[model samples]
Target: MKLRTCPRLQPLKESIRFLTRKPAQFSDGSRICKRTFAGHTTAQQACDALVYNRHGHYDDVLQLEKVLLPPVGDEDLRIKMLAAPVNPADINMLQGTYAILPPFPAVGGNEGLGEVLEVGSKVCDAKPGDWVIPVDAGFGTWRMEVVCKATDVIPVAKDIPLLSAATLGVNPCTAYRMLKDFGNLKPGDTVIQNGANSAVGQAVIQIAAGMGLSTINIIRDRPNLKELKDKLKSLGASLVITEEALQKPEVTNLFKDIRRPKLALNCVGGHSAGNLLAHMEYGSTMVTYGGMAKKPVPVPAKALIFKDINVCGFWMTQWKRNNMHDLSEIKAMVAELAEMVRRGQLSVPTCTQVPFPDYKVALDATTRAYSSKHVLMME
Candidate 1:
C-alpha cells in the first residue's frame, strides 16, 4: 500500500512516518508496518516520533497514525518505547470510567519500558541507551516513541526483561504500598488478602513471604482450585483458601496457632469484603484498593466499633505523587524483585502474548482470560 499524505501534515510526515515499509509478520501472527528514521544522521537529528491520535470518541479503540515528532525544548529526552502492558485500568480509561481523563487526540497507555534515544543538554542523570520507565501517571505511553522532561523517566536496569518491566509499574506498586503502608506487618505476622490470584494479590503473596510474613490468601472457587492453590503456595503463600471455606467454622479453628491477622487486603468488594474482614482480628485494618465486583465495600459497623477495625482505600498514583522521595526506594525494591526473578526465587504467572493485528480477537481473549492469568499483546 502507498503512503498517503495531507497538505497540512508536513511536520508529522517529516518526523514520524518518513521511511515507511510494508507491514511485516510478528511472532504472534500480527502485522506492523516498520518505520525508518531519516534526515538527521546522529542522535541529535532524531526527532520525536509516535503513533499519533488523529481523532476519536471515548468508546472507540484508538486509531493510531504515524505522525511527526512533536517539538521538544530544554530538559526533554526522546524515548523509544519497547513494550507496553494492557492493564484493567487502561481498559477503564478507554471506556472513560477512570477518575483521571487524558485530553482528546492523546496517545493512550499508562505504563511502558523504553530506551532513551536522545537527551537534552541540561539532562545530567540520564542519557541515550538508558532503559527507563515513566514516573508521571497519565502521560501517554502507547506510541513507538515520546519526548518528555528528563525527570519524568525512572532509569531501570537494561538487563531486566523489558516485557516484565512494562507490566510492573502500577499493579506491583499497588501491592507493595498497600502491604507496607496499612498492614505494618512484622516478620511473624500473618495477613489475609482476597483476590489472591490477581496481579497485585500475587505480588502481595510473594513480597509478604520475602519479608518473612505469612499470607492467608483467599480466592474465589474456580474449576481448578487445586492447581491455583499449588501455584500460589509455590510463590510463598502459607495457605490458600476458598471464599466458601471462610464460611466454615473449622477453617478459623485451623488458624489457632497463628495470631489473628492484623491486616486484610480487599480488592473484590461485595460479600467477598465481608468474608475477608471476618478473618481479621480486632484492632486491625482492611485496605480496599479496587472493586472488581463493581460493588461498594460492605462491612458491618459492629465489626468497626466492637472489633476496633479500620478500613481504608489505596491508589498508587496518589501515593507516588505525595511520596516522591520514596520513589528511589521503591525502585530499589523492584530491582530486588527483579533479582529474585533472576535467582528463581520469584515468578509471575504465565502470560500469553497476542499479536497486534489480532487486537480485536486478542482483546476479547484477554477479557475472557481475566479469570485465568494475565494476557499480554506484543508486536
Candidate 2:
C-alpha cells in the first residue's frame, strides 16, 4: 500500500510513532507540550488516539499517536473517553471498505462512552459530570479525549455499566431504529433475526421485550446452542433456534400461535436471510443492516410478488445525517434505551476490554467470529 502524506500533519517526519517529548506542533500550527501530550493528565490537556495517517491494514496503519485536543469552542464539550468497542464496522472503516471514509489521518472508533471533562464557557446541553456518547457517527471514540460541539454529545446515565454505555451508540441504536423505522410492529408481534446472538441482536431482544414484542432469534449451529438459547431467552427472546432447525416442522409449530414473524432483522445475509423471508408473514418487512455472511439477500421473487414483502436497509450513519438537523427524537430514544439498561432489562453485549497498548489483540479479534464484543479501554 502506498503511504500518503497528511497535509495537516506536517513537521512530524515519522507518521506512526507520535506522542514524542519534543515540542511538536499541530495542524493548526499550535504547539503541543510533551507533558500534556503524555495524556494521563486531566481532561484539559492533550491526549493520544488510535490514528492512521493513511488508510490500509489496521495493524499496519493504526498507531497510538499524540494529538492536540481541539480547543473547546463556544458551544463545545470536552469528553474523556471511557471505552470503545471494536466493531465490524470499525474494521471495515479501517480497511477502507465502509461507505463513509474518514479523511486522511483519521481515528478509528465510531461508538464509545465518555465522561464530560469540560464544557465550553457557552455550553449548556451537558455539564462536567455528565456521561455522554456521540450524537452522530464517526467521532473517533478510540482515544483518551475528544472535544466537540455540546450538541454533538448526548448525555447518558452513568449508573449503567461502562461496556453497555460504550456500545449504546451503535448496535443498540441500530437495532432500536430498525425495529421502529422499517415496520409497524405491535406488541406480541414476532420479529425474527439471523444474528440473534450478535450485539445488535441482543439489543433487539431486550428492546423488543420492553416494547412487548416477541423475538424469534436465529443463530448458527454451535455445540453450546442450549446455553446460548437460554441466555437469549433470559433476555426475553420468545424463541431461539439454529438455522438448521428452522426447516423443521417443530419450529414452525412453536410459532403457530404467535403467527409468522411480521418483521425480520437481517445482519447475516445469503441463505440465513432466505430462511427468514420464507417464514415472514405476508405484507411484512425485512430490514438488512449487516452482511456478515458476505452474501446477497437471496429473496425469492414469490415473496416479493405474492407475499407483498418489503425489503429495506438501515444504516445508523445515514439515519444520523437525515436527522442531524433534528436529533431530539434520537436523543429521546437513547435515553429510553439507557433506562432499559439501568433497570437490568437490557444486558450489555458480552465484552472483553483491551488496553490501548494491546490494541493488536482487539484489532485481530474483529476479523474473527468471536461471540463477545472487544472493547478498547483507556486508563
Candidate 3:
C-alpha cells in the first residue's frame, strides 16, 4: 500500500516498543492507560489511518499513516471498523467548510460501522461481537480500528446490510428526525422535498413510506431521468418529478389528486426552493437542511403574506450535540430505524464498495455528479 508522508510521523523501518504509561483514574474510580500488547510491539499494534494535520485541499493535506491507537480506557471499547462511506459532509469537513471542524492532526471520517473487539471492565453497555456506530459526527471512523468511550458509540443490530449499517448514523437519522419533528405529520400526509436523489432524500422516501406518509420527490432534470425516477419510486416515493416538472401547470393538476404538501424539505436552495414554497399548503413548514445549489433559499413575499409559510433549518450534527448527554431519544430513534431495516423498509442506496486500501478511488467517485455512493470496505 502507498503511504503519504506526514512530517509528524517518522518512518518505521522495524518493529518498535514502548513502556506502558501510568494509569489515570476516572469518575468511576477505574484506573486505565496501563496496557500490554501481548508480546506485540508498538509498531505491531499500529494501524493505517487517514489523517490531516491541517485543513485545506484534501488531496494536499490528507495522509495515510501507521498510527498506534491509545489503550482502551475503563469506560471505553476497542472497535474494528467494518465499512464507511465517503460523504459530502466528510469532504466539506476536510475543506474546513463544514459547521464542525476537528482540530489539526485529526482523522478524516465521521460515519462508519464497527464491531466491538474489546470492552473495558466498566463497559457493561457493550460487549465483544456487538455492532456499534458513533453517536455523533467527528469520531474519525476512517481508521482500521479505534478505542473510544463506550458512551460515545451506540450498539446496532448486525443483521442489516453492511452499507446500511455503515451509513445509519448520519443520513438515516437526519431523515428520521425531520419527518417526525416537522409539520406534525400523520399517516397519509403528503410531504415534498428537493434534492430527492441524495442519500438523505432516499432515506426520507423509505422512512416516510414506512410511516404511511407520501413523498413528492423532486430532482434536477438529467440524462437517464427515467432510470432515476424508477429507482426512487421503487423506494416508495409517491411521485418523482424533475425541478422543471415542479413548475409546469401539470404540477397543479398533480396536487389536485393528492393533498397539498404540508412539509417541504429543501436540500437544494435557490430557485429550486422557490418552487417548493410555491406548492406548500398554507401555514405549512419548510425545513432547509442543505444548500447543494450553494444558493440562498428564495421565499416569495406573496407566500409569506398569503400562505404564511414557516421556514427553519436543521443540522443533524447540532441536534446530536445538543442531546448527547441524554441518549434516550437517539437510542429510541435508532431502534425504530433498525426495525425498519430488519423489515426491509430501509435498504442500502446504489453504491460501489471500494476496498479500504483503495480509498482514493472512493473519494474520487464521491466528487463526480450522479455517481453511485462509494463506500470503503475494511475487508
RMSD in order of candidates = 9.2, 6.2, 8.4
For residues 1-379, could you state the per-residue lDDT of candidate 2 as single tens digits?
Answer: 1222323222222232333433344332223334354534444556778876556798788878767775666777777888888888888888777776655456778888899988788876778879998865566788887767677667788888888888888888898998887779888788999999998999999999998998899998888888989999999998888999997877768766776889999999999999899899999999999999899999899999999999989888777766767778878988888898889888877988899778889988888874478998887
- Candidate that would win on lDDT: 3
Q: To one decimal, what is the Cα RMSD in angstroms of model 1 from the true structure?
A: 9.2
- Clashing pairs for model 3 are none
Model 3 TM-score, 2 decimals: 0.88
- Residues 66-107 of candidate 1 have per-residue lDDT tens digits of 434534546778877776655667666665567654443345
Model 2 CA deviation exceeding 4 Å by range = 1-44
What lDDT, from 0 to 1, does candidate 2 have? Answer: 0.79
Model 3 lDDT tens row, 146-191: 7777887888888888788888888999999999999999998999
Q: What TM-score would every model get versus the actual structure? A: 0.81, 0.88, 0.88
Better of 2 and 3 by lDDT: 3
